[model samples]
Target: MSASQAPSQPVPPSWKDLGKAASDILGKDYPIHGSTLEVKTHTPSGVTFRVFGLHDNKSSAITGDLEASWFDRKKGISLTQAWSTANVLRNQIELQNHLAKGLKFELISTLVPEKQAKNALLATTYKAPGLHIRNFVDVFKGPLLTSDAVVGRDGLLLGAETAYDAREKKVARYNLALGFYAPDYAVALHALGNLTTYSASYYHRVNADVEASARATYDSKASSNVNLEVGTKTYLDNAAFVKAKVNNSGILALGYAQALRPGVKATFGLALDTLKLSSGSADASAHKIGASLTFEA
Candidate 1:
Protein backbone atom coordinates (compact mmCIF):
# COMPACT_ATOMS: atom_id res chain seq x y z
CA MET A 1 0.00 0.00 0.00
CA SER A 2 1.09 3.59 -0.59
CA ALA A 3 2.46 5.58 2.37
CA SER A 4 -0.55 7.88 2.42
CA GLN A 5 -2.95 4.98 2.46
CA ALA A 6 -1.20 3.03 5.16
CA PRO A 7 -2.68 2.93 8.64
CA SER A 8 -1.22 5.33 11.16
CA GLN A 9 0.37 4.20 14.40
CA PRO A 10 -1.63 4.45 17.59
CA VAL A 11 -1.20 7.44 19.89
CA PRO A 12 0.59 7.10 23.19
CA PRO A 13 -1.06 7.44 26.58
CA SER A 14 -1.15 10.80 28.40
CA TRP A 15 1.88 12.13 30.25
CA LYS A 16 0.35 11.23 33.61
CA ASP A 17 0.34 7.61 32.53
CA LEU A 18 3.94 7.47 31.33
CA GLY A 19 5.10 5.30 34.22
CA LYS A 20 1.79 3.72 35.16
CA ALA A 21 2.90 0.24 34.26
CA ALA A 22 5.54 0.21 36.96
CA SER A 23 3.64 2.30 39.50
CA ASP A 24 0.56 0.12 39.38
CA ILE A 25 2.52 -3.00 40.15
CA LEU A 26 4.58 -1.34 42.87
CA GLY A 27 1.87 0.54 44.79
CA LYS A 28 -1.42 -1.37 44.58
CA ASP A 29 -3.05 -3.48 47.34
CA TYR A 30 -0.29 -3.07 49.88
CA PRO A 31 -1.83 -1.27 52.81
CA ILE A 32 0.58 -0.84 55.71
CA HIS A 33 -1.95 -1.13 58.50
CA GLY A 34 -5.59 -1.72 59.35
CA SER A 35 -8.20 -3.92 57.74
CA THR A 36 -10.29 -2.60 54.89
CA LEU A 37 -13.58 -3.85 53.52
CA GLU A 38 -15.01 -2.67 50.22
CA VAL A 39 -18.25 -3.49 48.46
CA LYS A 40 -19.47 -2.44 45.05
CA THR A 41 -22.76 -3.00 43.32
CA HIS A 42 -24.01 -1.97 39.93
CA THR A 43 -27.56 -1.72 38.67
CA PRO A 44 -28.96 -2.08 35.21
CA SER A 45 -29.94 1.59 35.20
CA GLY A 46 -26.39 2.94 34.88
CA VAL A 47 -25.92 3.42 38.61
CA THR A 48 -23.07 2.17 40.75
CA PHE A 49 -22.73 2.12 44.52
CA ARG A 50 -19.54 1.65 46.49
CA VAL A 51 -18.87 1.29 50.18
CA PHE A 52 -15.52 1.23 51.93
CA GLY A 53 -14.68 0.74 55.57
CA LEU A 54 -11.39 0.79 57.42
CA HIS A 55 -10.81 -0.57 60.90
CA ASP A 56 -7.60 -0.35 62.85
CA ASN A 57 -6.34 -0.43 66.41
CA LYS A 58 -6.84 3.30 66.75
CA SER A 59 -10.06 4.08 64.96
CA SER A 60 -12.66 2.96 62.46
CA ALA A 61 -14.40 4.85 59.69
CA ILE A 62 -16.67 4.16 56.78
CA THR A 63 -17.13 5.97 53.49
CA GLY A 64 -19.14 5.43 50.36
CA ASP A 65 -19.99 6.89 46.97
CA LEU A 66 -22.79 6.68 44.47
CA GLU A 67 -22.22 7.30 40.79
CA ALA A 68 -24.72 7.55 38.00
CA SER A 69 -24.16 8.12 34.35
CA TRP A 70 -26.22 9.03 31.30
CA PHE A 71 -24.79 8.59 27.86
CA ASP A 72 -25.85 9.31 24.30
CA ARG A 73 -24.01 6.64 22.39
CA LYS A 74 -24.82 8.07 18.97
CA LYS A 75 -23.89 11.63 19.88
CA GLY A 76 -20.80 10.76 21.98
CA ILE A 77 -21.95 12.73 24.99
CA SER A 78 -21.74 11.53 28.58
CA LEU A 79 -23.04 13.04 31.80
CA THR A 80 -22.06 11.75 35.20
CA GLN A 81 -22.97 12.50 38.80
CA ALA A 82 -21.00 11.22 41.78
CA TRP A 83 -21.62 11.75 45.48
CA SER A 84 -18.97 10.68 47.95
CA THR A 85 -18.84 10.75 51.71
CA ALA A 86 -15.35 10.49 53.08
CA ASN A 87 -13.56 12.96 55.36
CA VAL A 88 -15.83 15.50 53.81
CA LEU A 89 -19.12 15.00 52.05
CA ARG A 90 -18.95 16.14 48.47
CA ASN A 91 -20.67 15.77 45.12
CA GLN A 92 -19.30 16.07 41.62
CA ILE A 93 -21.05 16.52 38.30
CA GLU A 94 -19.23 16.05 35.02
CA LEU A 95 -20.05 16.29 31.36
CA GLN A 96 -17.94 15.01 28.44
CA ASN A 97 -18.40 15.15 24.74
CA HIS A 98 -16.39 14.77 21.61
CA LEU A 99 -15.99 18.06 19.80
CA ALA A 100 -14.30 16.72 16.70
CA LYS A 101 -12.83 13.54 15.38
CA GLY A 102 -9.70 13.75 17.52
CA LEU A 103 -10.70 16.29 20.16
CA LYS A 104 -12.84 15.97 23.31
CA PHE A 105 -14.10 18.36 25.97
CA GLU A 106 -14.89 17.80 29.65
CA LEU A 107 -16.27 19.98 32.42
CA ILE A 108 -16.46 19.05 36.07
CA SER A 109 -17.89 20.87 39.07
CA THR A 110 -17.58 19.88 42.70
CA LEU A 111 -19.87 20.79 45.59
CA VAL A 112 -18.97 20.56 49.24
CA PRO A 113 -20.90 20.65 52.50
CA GLU A 114 -21.41 24.41 52.84
CA LYS A 115 -20.37 25.51 49.36
CA GLN A 116 -22.83 25.10 46.50
CA ALA A 117 -20.00 25.09 44.00
CA LYS A 118 -16.61 24.56 45.54
CA ASN A 119 -14.61 24.29 42.36
CA ALA A 120 -14.92 23.75 38.66
CA LEU A 121 -12.35 22.36 36.22
CA LEU A 122 -12.39 22.40 32.46
CA ALA A 123 -10.35 19.90 30.45
CA THR A 124 -9.80 19.06 26.85
CA THR A 125 -7.97 16.19 25.19
CA TYR A 126 -6.80 15.59 21.69
CA LYS A 127 -5.33 12.44 20.20
CA ALA A 128 -3.93 11.98 16.74
CA PRO A 129 -1.94 9.27 15.03
CA GLY A 130 1.12 9.37 17.30
CA LEU A 131 0.44 12.35 19.53
CA HIS A 132 -1.72 13.14 22.54
CA ILE A 133 -2.42 16.40 24.33
CA ARG A 134 -4.39 17.36 27.42
CA ASN A 135 -5.15 20.73 28.99
CA PHE A 136 -6.87 21.53 32.26
CA VAL A 137 -7.91 24.75 33.99
CA ASP A 138 -9.39 25.33 37.39
CA VAL A 139 -11.92 28.04 36.71
CA PHE A 140 -13.12 28.38 40.29
CA LYS A 141 -10.03 28.96 42.42
CA GLY A 142 -6.89 30.76 41.28
CA PRO A 143 -7.61 29.76 37.71
CA LEU A 144 -4.53 27.53 37.56
CA LEU A 145 -3.83 26.08 34.16
CA THR A 146 -1.99 22.87 33.22
CA SER A 147 -1.06 21.20 29.98
CA ASP A 148 0.49 17.86 28.98
CA ALA A 149 1.58 16.45 25.69
CA VAL A 150 3.05 13.15 24.55
CA VAL A 151 4.36 11.91 21.26
CA GLY A 152 5.26 8.37 20.38
CA ARG A 153 6.46 6.51 17.34
CA ASP A 154 7.78 2.96 17.05
CA GLY A 155 7.58 2.34 20.80
CA LEU A 156 9.61 5.41 21.84
CA LEU A 157 7.79 8.15 23.73
CA LEU A 158 8.55 11.67 24.94
CA GLY A 159 6.29 13.73 27.13
CA ALA A 160 6.20 16.95 29.11
CA GLU A 161 3.78 18.56 31.53
CA THR A 162 3.58 22.01 33.06
CA ALA A 163 1.33 24.00 35.33
CA TYR A 164 0.88 27.78 35.36
CA ASP A 165 -0.42 29.99 38.12
CA ALA A 166 -2.57 32.39 36.17
CA ARG A 167 -3.31 34.55 39.18
CA GLU A 168 0.33 34.87 40.16
CA LYS A 169 1.48 35.23 36.59
CA LYS A 170 4.23 32.67 36.91
CA VAL A 171 4.98 29.09 36.06
CA ALA A 172 4.17 26.79 38.93
CA ARG A 173 5.84 23.49 38.00
CA TYR A 174 7.08 21.47 35.08
CA ASN A 175 8.09 17.86 34.44
CA LEU A 176 9.75 16.02 31.60
CA ALA A 177 9.79 12.31 30.85
CA LEU A 178 11.19 9.89 28.33
CA GLY A 179 9.89 6.37 28.00
CA PHE A 180 9.72 3.28 25.91
CA TYR A 181 6.68 1.04 25.86
CA ALA A 182 6.54 -2.41 24.37
CA PRO A 183 4.26 -5.39 24.50
CA ASP A 184 6.17 -7.09 27.28
CA TYR A 185 8.24 -4.41 28.93
CA ALA A 186 8.20 -0.66 29.65
CA VAL A 187 10.67 1.84 31.07
CA ALA A 188 10.43 5.49 32.00
CA LEU A 189 12.79 8.22 33.21
CA HIS A 190 11.33 11.32 34.76
CA ALA A 191 12.65 14.67 35.94
CA LEU A 192 10.12 16.07 38.39
CA GLY A 193 9.67 18.76 41.03
CA ASN A 194 11.23 21.40 38.82
CA LEU A 195 14.19 19.09 38.20
CA THR A 196 14.88 18.73 41.89
CA THR A 197 14.11 15.04 41.81
CA TYR A 198 14.79 12.37 39.24
CA SER A 199 13.09 8.99 39.07
CA ALA A 200 13.36 5.92 36.92
CA SER A 201 11.07 2.92 36.68
CA TYR A 202 11.03 -0.31 34.77
CA TYR A 203 8.41 -3.01 34.36
CA HIS A 204 8.71 -6.35 32.67
CA ARG A 205 6.30 -9.21 32.24
CA VAL A 206 8.56 -12.21 32.44
CA ASN A 207 5.93 -14.68 31.41
CA ALA A 208 2.22 -15.24 31.47
CA ASP A 209 2.14 -15.49 35.25
CA VAL A 210 5.01 -13.35 36.50
CA GLU A 211 5.80 -9.63 36.45
CA ALA A 212 8.63 -7.59 37.94
CA SER A 213 9.09 -3.90 38.53
CA ALA A 214 11.77 -1.62 39.94
CA ARG A 215 11.83 2.05 40.82
CA ALA A 216 14.51 4.45 42.02
CA THR A 217 14.52 8.08 42.94
CA TYR A 218 17.27 10.61 43.59
CA ASP A 219 16.89 14.05 45.09
CA SER A 220 19.38 16.57 43.79
CA LYS A 221 18.78 18.79 46.81
CA ALA A 222 19.80 16.11 49.29
CA SER A 223 23.27 14.72 50.03
CA SER A 224 23.59 11.17 48.81
CA ASN A 225 19.85 10.72 49.16
CA VAL A 226 18.77 7.97 46.81
CA ASN A 227 16.02 5.42 47.30
CA LEU A 228 15.53 2.20 45.37
CA GLU A 229 12.90 -0.49 45.50
CA VAL A 230 12.27 -3.68 43.59
CA GLY A 231 9.08 -5.69 43.51
CA THR A 232 7.76 -8.81 41.88
CA LYS A 233 4.34 -10.39 41.45
CA THR A 234 3.74 -14.02 40.68
CA TYR A 235 0.47 -15.78 40.07
CA LEU A 236 0.34 -19.11 41.83
CA ASP A 237 -2.74 -20.13 39.92
CA ASN A 238 -5.74 -18.68 38.23
CA ALA A 239 -7.23 -17.65 41.59
CA ALA A 240 -4.24 -16.66 43.69
CA PHE A 241 -1.30 -14.29 43.41
CA VAL A 242 1.59 -13.18 45.62
CA LYS A 243 3.78 -10.09 45.66
CA ALA A 244 7.02 -9.22 47.41
CA LYS A 245 9.07 -6.05 47.53
CA VAL A 246 12.13 -4.73 49.32
CA ASN A 247 13.70 -1.33 49.59
CA ASN A 248 17.24 -0.09 50.23
CA SER A 249 16.18 1.04 53.70
CA GLY A 250 15.99 -2.59 54.82
CA ILE A 251 12.20 -2.82 54.68
CA LEU A 252 10.52 -5.83 53.18
CA ALA A 253 6.87 -6.19 52.24
CA LEU A 254 4.89 -9.19 51.12
CA GLY A 255 1.31 -9.49 49.96
CA TYR A 256 -0.95 -12.37 49.02
CA ALA A 257 -4.33 -12.19 47.37
CA GLN A 258 -6.82 -14.94 46.66
CA ALA A 259 -10.13 -15.00 44.90
CA LEU A 260 -12.59 -16.42 47.39
CA ARG A 261 -15.46 -16.54 44.99
CA PRO A 262 -16.57 -15.21 41.64
CA GLY A 263 -17.07 -11.74 43.01
CA VAL A 264 -15.24 -11.81 46.27
CA LYS A 265 -11.51 -11.45 46.95
CA ALA A 266 -9.26 -11.22 49.99
CA THR A 267 -5.79 -9.74 50.41
CA PHE A 268 -3.28 -9.89 53.23
CA GLY A 269 -0.09 -7.87 53.59
CA LEU A 270 2.85 -7.81 55.97
CA ALA A 271 5.88 -5.55 56.28
CA LEU A 272 8.98 -6.03 58.36
CA ASP A 273 12.06 -4.02 59.24
CA THR A 274 14.85 -6.23 58.03
CA LEU A 275 17.51 -4.18 59.76
CA LYS A 276 15.96 -4.82 63.15
CA LEU A 277 15.50 -8.45 62.24
CA SER A 278 19.23 -8.79 61.57
CA SER A 279 20.05 -7.23 64.95
CA GLY A 280 17.69 -9.72 66.70
CA SER A 281 15.97 -6.79 68.36
CA ALA A 282 12.82 -6.66 66.33
CA ASP A 283 9.55 -6.64 68.22
CA ALA A 284 5.96 -7.08 67.16
CA SER A 285 5.61 -3.31 66.92
CA ALA A 286 8.36 -3.22 64.35
CA HIS A 287 6.25 -5.23 61.94
CA LYS A 288 3.01 -4.17 60.31
CA ILE A 289 0.18 -6.34 59.06
CA GLY A 290 -2.90 -5.53 57.04
CA ALA A 291 -5.74 -7.27 55.26
CA SER A 292 -8.58 -6.33 52.97
CA LEU A 293 -11.76 -7.85 51.65
CA THR A 294 -13.50 -6.87 48.43
CA PHE A 295 -16.92 -7.77 47.08
CA GLU A 296 -18.30 -6.78 43.72
CA ALA A 297 -21.48 -7.48 41.84
Candidate 2:
Protein backbone atom coordinates (compact mmCIF):
# COMPACT_ATOMS: atom_id res chain seq x y z
CA MET A 1 0.00 0.00 0.00
CA SER A 2 1.13 3.51 -0.67
CA ALA A 3 2.02 5.74 2.26
CA SER A 4 -1.08 7.81 1.74
CA GLN A 5 -3.26 4.71 1.67
CA ALA A 6 -2.07 3.26 4.93
CA PRO A 7 -4.83 2.60 7.44
CA SER A 8 -5.15 5.09 10.23
CA GLN A 9 -4.14 3.98 13.71
CA PRO A 10 -6.83 2.98 16.15
CA VAL A 11 -6.92 4.54 19.63
CA PRO A 12 -9.51 3.11 21.95
CA PRO A 13 -10.39 4.71 25.25
CA SER A 14 -10.59 2.81 28.52
CA TRP A 15 -13.81 1.02 29.56
CA LYS A 16 -14.32 3.43 32.44
CA ASP A 17 -14.37 6.29 29.97
CA LEU A 18 -16.96 4.83 27.59
CA GLY A 19 -19.54 7.52 28.36
CA LYS A 20 -17.09 10.29 29.10
CA ALA A 21 -18.07 12.30 26.06
CA ALA A 22 -21.69 12.65 27.08
CA SER A 23 -20.80 12.95 30.75
CA ASP A 24 -18.41 15.76 30.02
CA ILE A 25 -21.09 17.64 28.17
CA LEU A 26 -23.99 16.92 30.47
CA GLY A 27 -22.44 16.71 33.94
CA LYS A 28 -19.15 18.56 34.12
CA ASP A 29 -18.45 22.16 35.23
CA TYR A 30 -21.82 22.52 36.92
CA PRO A 31 -21.04 23.48 40.49
CA ILE A 32 -23.36 22.79 43.40
CA HIS A 33 -23.80 24.78 46.58
CA GLY A 34 -20.36 26.17 47.33
CA SER A 35 -17.54 28.52 46.35
CA THR A 36 -14.07 27.46 45.32
CA LEU A 37 -10.79 29.12 44.39
CA GLU A 38 -7.83 27.36 42.82
CA VAL A 39 -4.35 28.57 41.96
CA LYS A 40 -1.62 26.63 40.17
CA THR A 41 1.97 27.41 39.32
CA HIS A 42 4.34 25.46 37.10
CA THR A 43 8.10 25.88 36.87
CA PRO A 44 10.55 25.07 34.08
CA SER A 45 12.04 22.31 36.25
CA GLY A 46 8.91 20.15 35.85
CA VAL A 47 7.60 21.00 39.26
CA THR A 48 4.09 22.30 39.98
CA PHE A 49 2.17 23.53 42.99
CA ARG A 50 -1.54 24.04 43.53
CA VAL A 51 -3.72 25.49 46.23
CA PHE A 52 -7.47 25.21 46.64
CA GLY A 53 -9.89 26.88 49.01
CA LEU A 54 -13.59 26.16 49.42
CA HIS A 55 -16.25 27.91 51.42
CA ASP A 56 -19.91 27.41 52.14
CA ASN A 57 -22.54 28.63 54.53
CA LYS A 58 -21.29 26.37 57.27
CA SER A 59 -17.77 25.30 56.51
CA SER A 60 -14.49 26.19 54.82
CA ALA A 61 -11.38 24.24 53.95
CA ILE A 62 -8.03 24.51 52.22
CA THR A 63 -5.96 22.05 50.24
CA GLY A 64 -2.52 22.04 48.67
CA ASP A 65 -0.80 19.84 46.09
CA LEU A 66 2.72 19.50 44.75
CA GLU A 67 4.01 17.46 41.83
CA ALA A 68 7.39 16.83 40.24
CA SER A 69 7.99 15.08 36.95
CA TRP A 70 11.02 13.70 35.08
CA PHE A 71 11.73 11.63 32.00
CA ASP A 72 9.56 13.82 29.84
CA ARG A 73 6.66 13.54 32.28
CA LYS A 74 6.70 9.75 32.06
CA LYS A 75 7.68 9.51 35.72
CA GLY A 76 6.21 11.67 38.44
CA ILE A 77 5.50 12.02 42.15
CA SER A 78 2.67 14.03 43.69
CA LEU A 79 1.37 14.79 47.14
CA THR A 80 -1.93 16.29 48.24
CA GLN A 81 -2.70 17.65 51.68
CA ALA A 82 -5.97 19.08 52.92
CA TRP A 83 -7.14 20.68 56.13
CA SER A 84 -10.54 21.73 57.36
CA THR A 85 -11.43 24.22 60.04
CA ALA A 86 -13.00 21.35 61.95
CA ASN A 87 -9.48 20.07 62.73
CA VAL A 88 -9.40 17.34 60.08
CA LEU A 89 -6.30 16.62 58.06
CA ARG A 90 -5.89 14.39 55.05
CA ASN A 91 -2.79 13.59 53.00
CA GLN A 92 -2.04 11.32 50.07
CA ILE A 93 0.95 10.55 47.91
CA GLU A 94 1.12 9.12 44.40
CA LEU A 95 3.99 7.77 42.33
CA GLN A 96 3.71 7.01 38.63
CA ASN A 97 6.04 5.54 36.04
CA HIS A 98 5.81 4.34 32.49
CA LEU A 99 7.21 0.83 32.39
CA ALA A 100 7.18 0.17 28.64
CA LYS A 101 5.81 1.39 25.34
CA GLY A 102 2.19 0.80 26.32
CA LEU A 103 2.30 -0.03 30.01
CA LYS A 104 2.24 2.22 33.06
CA PHE A 105 2.11 1.69 36.82
CA GLU A 106 0.97 3.79 39.76
CA LEU A 107 1.18 3.56 43.53
CA ILE A 108 -1.06 5.60 45.79
CA SER A 109 -0.77 5.82 49.57
CA THR A 110 -2.73 7.75 52.16
CA LEU A 111 -0.50 8.88 55.00
CA VAL A 112 -2.86 10.76 57.28
CA PRO A 113 -5.94 9.38 59.03
CA GLU A 114 -3.85 6.35 59.83
CA LYS A 115 -6.64 4.19 61.13
CA GLN A 116 -7.56 2.98 57.64
CA ALA A 117 -5.92 -0.35 56.84
CA LYS A 118 -6.52 -0.27 53.07
CA ASN A 119 -4.79 3.01 52.55
CA ALA A 120 -2.60 1.97 49.66
CA LEU A 121 -3.43 0.98 46.10
CA LEU A 122 -1.52 -0.49 43.18
CA ALA A 123 -2.67 0.18 39.66
CA THR A 124 -1.46 -0.45 36.13
CA THR A 125 -2.69 0.30 32.65
CA TYR A 126 -1.87 -0.93 29.17
CA LYS A 127 -2.97 0.51 25.86
CA ALA A 128 -2.40 -0.42 22.24
CA PRO A 129 -4.12 -0.15 18.93
CA GLY A 130 -7.81 -0.90 19.45
CA LEU A 131 -7.36 -2.19 23.00
CA HIS A 132 -7.05 -0.79 26.52
CA ILE A 133 -6.91 -2.43 29.93
CA ARG A 134 -6.63 -1.23 33.53
CA ASN A 135 -6.27 -3.01 36.85
CA PHE A 136 -6.20 -1.97 40.47
CA VAL A 137 -5.48 -3.83 43.70
CA ASP A 138 -5.47 -2.93 47.34
CA VAL A 139 -2.00 -3.00 48.90
CA PHE A 140 -3.27 -3.94 52.34
CA LYS A 141 -6.32 -5.47 53.95
CA GLY A 142 -8.51 -7.68 51.74
CA PRO A 143 -6.49 -6.98 48.63
CA LEU A 144 -9.56 -6.06 46.69
CA LEU A 145 -9.00 -6.21 42.98
CA THR A 146 -10.65 -4.67 39.94
CA SER A 147 -10.05 -4.90 36.21
CA ASP A 148 -11.47 -3.25 33.12
CA ALA A 149 -10.93 -3.83 29.43
CA VAL A 150 -12.17 -2.24 26.25
CA VAL A 151 -11.80 -3.12 22.58
CA GLY A 152 -12.59 -0.98 19.61
CA ARG A 153 -12.70 -1.35 15.84
CA ASP A 154 -14.12 0.89 13.19
CA GLY A 155 -15.42 3.26 15.89
CA LEU A 156 -17.42 0.56 17.68
CA LEU A 157 -16.47 -0.31 21.23
CA LEU A 158 -17.27 -3.13 23.68
CA GLY A 159 -16.10 -3.15 27.25
CA ALA A 160 -16.47 -4.89 30.61
CA GLU A 161 -15.34 -4.35 34.15
CA THR A 162 -15.41 -6.41 37.34
CA ALA A 163 -14.41 -6.12 40.96
CA TYR A 164 -13.54 -8.95 43.37
CA ASP A 165 -13.29 -8.84 47.13
CA ALA A 166 -10.63 -11.24 48.30
CA ARG A 167 -11.68 -11.15 51.91
CA GLU A 168 -15.29 -11.82 51.08
CA LYS A 169 -14.25 -14.43 48.51
CA LYS A 170 -16.83 -13.15 46.07
CA VAL A 171 -17.40 -10.95 43.13
CA ALA A 172 -18.41 -7.50 44.23
CA ARG A 173 -19.62 -5.99 41.01
CA TYR A 174 -19.57 -6.26 37.23
CA ASN A 175 -20.50 -4.00 34.36
CA LEU A 176 -20.68 -4.03 30.58
CA ALA A 177 -20.86 -1.29 27.99
CA LEU A 178 -21.14 -0.62 24.28
CA GLY A 179 -20.23 2.56 22.50
CA PHE A 180 -19.89 4.11 19.06
CA TYR A 181 -17.64 7.10 18.55
CA ALA A 182 -17.59 9.34 15.52
CA PRO A 183 -16.04 12.66 14.76
CA ASP A 184 -19.26 14.63 15.29
CA TYR A 185 -21.32 12.40 17.56
CA ALA A 186 -21.09 9.53 20.07
CA VAL A 187 -23.43 7.08 21.77
CA ALA A 188 -22.96 4.79 24.73
CA LEU A 189 -24.96 2.22 26.67
CA HIS A 190 -24.10 0.64 29.98
CA ALA A 191 -25.33 -2.13 32.24
CA LEU A 192 -24.05 -1.26 35.70
CA GLY A 193 -24.55 -2.11 39.36
CA ASN A 194 -24.41 -5.85 38.69
CA LEU A 195 -26.74 -5.32 35.73
CA THR A 196 -29.50 -3.87 37.85
CA THR A 197 -29.07 -0.39 36.41
CA TYR A 198 -29.06 0.55 32.73
CA SER A 199 -28.03 3.83 31.19
CA ALA A 200 -27.70 5.39 27.76
CA SER A 201 -26.05 8.61 26.65
CA TYR A 202 -25.68 10.55 23.45
CA TYR A 203 -23.47 13.50 22.53
CA HIS A 204 -23.45 15.62 19.42
CA ARG A 205 -21.52 18.59 18.22
CA VAL A 206 -24.18 20.77 16.69
CA ASN A 207 -21.77 23.26 15.18
CA ALA A 208 -18.40 24.85 15.68
CA ASP A 209 -19.64 26.70 18.74
CA VAL A 210 -22.40 24.49 20.08
CA GLU A 211 -22.60 21.02 21.68
CA ALA A 212 -25.50 19.09 23.15
CA SER A 213 -25.88 15.91 25.18
CA ALA A 214 -28.45 13.78 26.96
CA ARG A 215 -28.45 10.82 29.34
CA ALA A 216 -31.07 8.51 30.82
CA THR A 217 -30.90 5.85 33.48
CA TYR A 218 -33.28 3.15 34.71
CA ASP A 219 -33.07 0.84 37.67
CA SER A 220 -34.56 -2.59 37.29
CA LYS A 221 -34.55 -3.17 41.03
CA ALA A 222 -36.74 -0.09 41.48
CA SER A 223 -39.06 0.27 38.56
CA SER A 224 -40.12 3.69 39.73
CA ASN A 225 -36.60 5.03 39.73
CA VAL A 226 -35.74 6.67 36.46
CA ASN A 227 -33.59 9.66 35.65
CA LEU A 228 -33.07 11.79 32.56
CA GLU A 229 -30.93 14.85 31.96
CA VAL A 230 -30.25 17.03 28.94
CA GLY A 231 -27.75 19.80 28.53
CA THR A 232 -26.09 22.14 26.07
CA LYS A 233 -22.85 24.09 25.89
CA THR A 234 -22.35 27.16 23.76
CA TYR A 235 -19.19 29.11 23.19
CA LEU A 236 -19.79 32.82 23.03
CA ASP A 237 -16.34 33.56 21.78
CA ASN A 238 -12.77 32.42 22.10
CA ALA A 239 -12.59 33.09 25.81
CA ALA A 240 -16.14 32.58 27.13
CA PHE A 241 -18.68 29.76 27.26
CA VAL A 242 -21.93 28.88 28.95
CA LYS A 243 -23.66 25.64 29.93
CA ALA A 244 -27.16 24.80 31.06
CA LYS A 245 -28.84 21.54 32.09
CA VAL A 246 -32.07 20.25 33.56
CA ASN A 247 -32.88 16.93 35.16
CA ASN A 248 -36.04 14.88 35.61
CA SER A 249 -36.52 16.16 39.14
CA GLY A 250 -37.01 19.73 37.87
CA ILE A 251 -33.58 20.95 38.92
CA LEU A 252 -32.05 23.43 36.53
CA ALA A 253 -28.36 24.32 36.54
CA LEU A 254 -26.46 27.04 34.75
CA GLY A 255 -22.76 27.79 34.49
CA TYR A 256 -20.69 30.48 32.85
CA ALA A 257 -16.94 30.42 32.42
CA GLN A 258 -14.59 33.03 31.04
CA ALA A 259 -10.90 33.56 30.67
CA LEU A 260 -9.80 36.75 32.42
CA ARG A 261 -6.23 36.81 31.17
CA PRO A 262 -3.38 34.64 29.99
CA GLY A 263 -3.30 32.43 33.06
CA VAL A 264 -6.53 33.22 34.90
CA LYS A 265 -10.11 32.05 34.52
CA ALA A 266 -13.36 32.31 36.46
CA THR A 267 -16.59 30.34 36.60
CA PHE A 268 -19.97 31.04 38.16
CA GLY A 269 -22.78 28.58 38.70
CA LEU A 270 -26.37 28.59 39.91
CA ALA A 271 -28.89 25.86 40.56
CA LEU A 272 -32.62 26.24 41.09
CA ASP A 273 -35.48 23.94 41.94
CA THR A 274 -38.00 24.76 39.27
CA LEU A 275 -40.75 22.86 41.04
CA LYS A 276 -40.35 24.94 44.15
CA LEU A 277 -40.15 28.07 42.08
CA SER A 278 -43.44 27.34 40.36
CA SER A 279 -45.09 26.63 43.67
CA GLY A 280 -43.95 30.01 45.03
CA SER A 281 -42.19 28.44 48.00
CA ALA A 282 -38.61 28.95 46.92
CA ASP A 283 -36.34 30.82 49.28
CA ALA A 284 -32.72 31.94 49.14
CA SER A 285 -31.68 28.79 50.96
CA ALA A 286 -33.59 26.69 48.45
CA HIS A 287 -31.22 27.68 45.66
CA LYS A 288 -27.51 27.15 45.27
CA ILE A 289 -24.87 29.59 44.06
CA GLY A 290 -21.20 28.98 43.51
CA ALA A 291 -18.16 30.57 41.94
CA SER A 292 -14.66 29.39 41.12
CA LEU A 293 -11.47 31.16 40.22
CA THR A 294 -8.53 29.37 38.65
CA PHE A 295 -5.03 30.55 37.95
CA GLU A 296 -2.34 28.63 36.11
CA ALA A 297 1.14 29.50 34.99
- The top-ranked prediction according to TM-score is 1
Give the C-alpha miss distance for residue 244 in model 2, angstroms.
0.5
Candidates in order have lDDT scores of 0.84, 0.81
**Which portions of model 1 miss their true places by more than 4 Å?**
56-89, 93-97, 114-117, 278-280
Candidate 2 C-alpha lDDT tens digits along 1-297: 997897865879998789898999887777665777887877776656666667763454443343333323545555555554433454555555544667777666654444433367788888888889999997675778999999998999999999999999999999999999999999999999999999999999999999999999999988867799999999999999999999999989999999999889999999998878855666666678888889998
Superposition error at 72 for model 2 (Å)? 4.5
lDDT of 1 at 214: 99
State the RMSD for candidate 1: 2.5
- Mark the regions of model 2 whose C-alpha exceeds 4 Å error after superposition: 1-8, 57-99, 113-118
For residues 1-297, could you state the per-residue lDDT of candidate 1 as single tens digits? 998998788989899899898997888878667788888787776566677767763355555565556655566666766767643443444334545677888887777765554777888888888999999999976689999999999889999999999899999999999999999999999999998899999999999999999999998988577899999999999999999999999889999999999999999999998878855666777788889999999
Clashing pairs in 1: none
Determine the backbone clash count of candidate 2.
0
- Find the number of clashing residue pairs for candidate 1: 0
